[model samples]
Target: MNALKGQTLEIVQEEFANKILQIQGVGGFILVRNNGQLLASKTDMTTDPQTLAAMMILSSQDCKTLQSTMGFSRYHYLMVTQEKIGKLY
Candidate 1:
């Protein structure tokens, strides 16, 4: 399992924060690898990064499966939104 550290982590966090700031109504955001490893996050919400990453990975896989079954092309991006929670990948 590769881990982000030191200046690399700092840079990633800063970038994520900056990107989130550009969006409205974004409570928080997390950056994770395809294998569910957390890279960085910016949020005041009390959610666990590891759990969120896992859920994201699962959700992405499910989307791919659904797309294949429907004979659609790959998705360019994915977003999930709720009353208080939203995610983009």
Candidate 2:
């Protein structure tokens, strides 16, 4: 009895690239909607837009997996933030 989680999912997604090179770090973070859709993400690749699209799919899959594992009744949104990141130097 397999569950149909992402089968009937609708997502309104968006992607963002935070060029915080002046601040620090290289790789950014990813965000998604509650319905397993891309909300926003950051990248610096010429073709990162496309890659991020794919990454969203993977992220959704991973989230769904976790939900199934933990028996989460509903799938919610994913929030990724980098407001307060610390360094160990």
Candidate 2: where are CA atoms >4 Å away? 1-47, 82-89
The superposed Cα distance between candidate 2 and the true structure at residue 6, in angstroms, equals 31
Residues 18-63, candidate 1, lDDT per residue (tens digit)? 8877898766778888888887777666667788789889988998
TM-score result, candidate 2? 0.37
Q: Scored by CA lDDT, what does every candidate get?
A: 0.75, 0.50
TM-score of each: 0.66, 0.37
Best by the TM-score measure: 1
Would you list the clashing residue pairs of candidate 2? Answer: 13-38, 14-38, 16-41
Model 2, 1-89: lDDT tens per residue? 12245442222222113433334654655454545555455544444544556656776688889989998866566544434433211
Question: Over all chains combined, what TM-score does candidate 1 have?
Answer: 0.66
Q: Which residue window of length 10 is worst by lDDT in model 1?
A: 1-10
- Counting clashing residue pairs in each candidate, in order, gives 0, 3
